[model samples]
Target: MRKLLYLTGLFILYSMQSMAQANDYVQIQAGSYQLGDTASLANPKRTVYIESFWISKFELTNAEFEKFVQATSYKTLAERYHNAMVFEPGLAEFRWLQDSTAYWRFPNGVSRGGIEAKMDHPVTCISYKDVLAYCRWADCRLPSFDEWEVAARAGSEGYYFEGFSKENMSEYANVWHGRDHLKADYSDGYLYTSPVGKFKPSPWGLFDIFGNVFEFCTGKLHGDGDRYVAHARGGSWWCSKNSCSAFNTVYIGSVRPNASFSNLGFRVVKKAFTPGDKDF
Candidate 1:
């Protein structure tokens, strides 16, 4: 019994070490950073500064998130409530309920078609509050709006690390264009979340910043007020190409963190620098 216990302890320590090492973050130059193009004050290419810190290279996977829930027995907001809002067009054949059990574990649970694949994908249907708990439990915190944008852009102005175009999105992201959802076979493309790190990493070594899931951050959606909400960065698999502003930009203007839905999830961040030890 002693030998078995020792082995288990050793294995647990090794796993924690490995997970820590895997958290690779980039160091953006300490200075002002741009937000977005013209015509949108919400993201008017404003400049912001941030202290350096280590952030996860990818969003939390189902496997990692599962571990958190296992240890904490934390019931997600959706799971607590019997249902959540689902956004699907009205079909001539059937009626879709406004609220359904759309928790992260069972996305599209009430849909007509089945969802047996992509269980390992990042868990969506998560609200900002759920993500906040995960971050705190992991001994980390969500990145601020500016920090997320800087890390995502990785000092590049292109659509992604490889640059954007109709030709390259298939390899870099899961946007609505280029055969993801417009297919009839249901087996062609964009049916579900691709495995983490399945695509190339950005210049700073981050993955899936353009699609897959909209990551929840620690920042408030808009100016501080009694009625404020947490914000999410990046776009999700269900977002359209023409409306890719959610992906192209970063900031949490006006949203409530506890809003339960399927289009939200989060990543983690670790401390890598001292706030007062500025050299730039």
Candidate 2:
């Protein structure tokens, strides 16, 4: 009788644990996204399988990033290095030239006083290495390319789940909402960033995965600027219709690991697989 009771208790514990894993995760229906189309841009579609895992429902907010900085006193690459390509107002002042003083805190570095913005907007001007370091501190990591895509697409087939037309960009992303670089008013009355979760959540409950900022991903590259580094994905706020499209598939590297840009940032993903795990 004692042995039977013990066995039953163990069985119940095992069942509960199994059920938790299944219910805690959302299964991303695996598929392929064609690259280099009006929808896919100049990227080639590749086969990728991403396992189930939990991701942030929204981009890392400035308030949250501040917590990381406060705890670790971690200096972002942008701070350690200058001329980091910031977006400042006034075309004549910053016309076709990168600002050497630009960093995460001072995106364009035009403000003489300091940042007075709110803290809920997605943190930008962060490098891949900085993201990786933050993730490590939090016991989290960046999502893979396929994982990021699956979350971004949110089970949609349209050029953008919101729509493919440029006219629809403002409703979905922060791209060219108010500012127009061609005109002086381009810098007038624009919120460089908005609070995270301000936009509607994707079908999978992820927020701002497509536009607020480009996210870093985990992948080894063998060509282009990625020959010696991993690549990042998603477009950024600085993107333009003719020059930079935030919805397109793009990638960069973490080889230097110290490189930082205002347009770059990242999201976190929990590891679902471990060594010798044949469950993939």
lDDT of 2 at 199: 61
Give the TM-score of each candidate: 0.76, 0.72
TM-score of candidate 2 relative to the true fold: 0.72
Deviation of model 2 at 219, angstroms: 1.3
Indicate the worst ten consecutive residues by lDDT in candidate 1: 179-188
Clashes (backbone N, CA, C under 3 Å), per candidate, total: 7, 3
lDDT digits (tens) for residues 73-103 of candidate 2: 9988777766465554445422444566666
Instruction: Please list the C-alpha lDDT of all candidates, in the order they appear.
Output: 0.63, 0.60
lDDT value, candidate 1, whole model: 0.63
In model 2, how large is the Cα lDDT of residue 252? 38
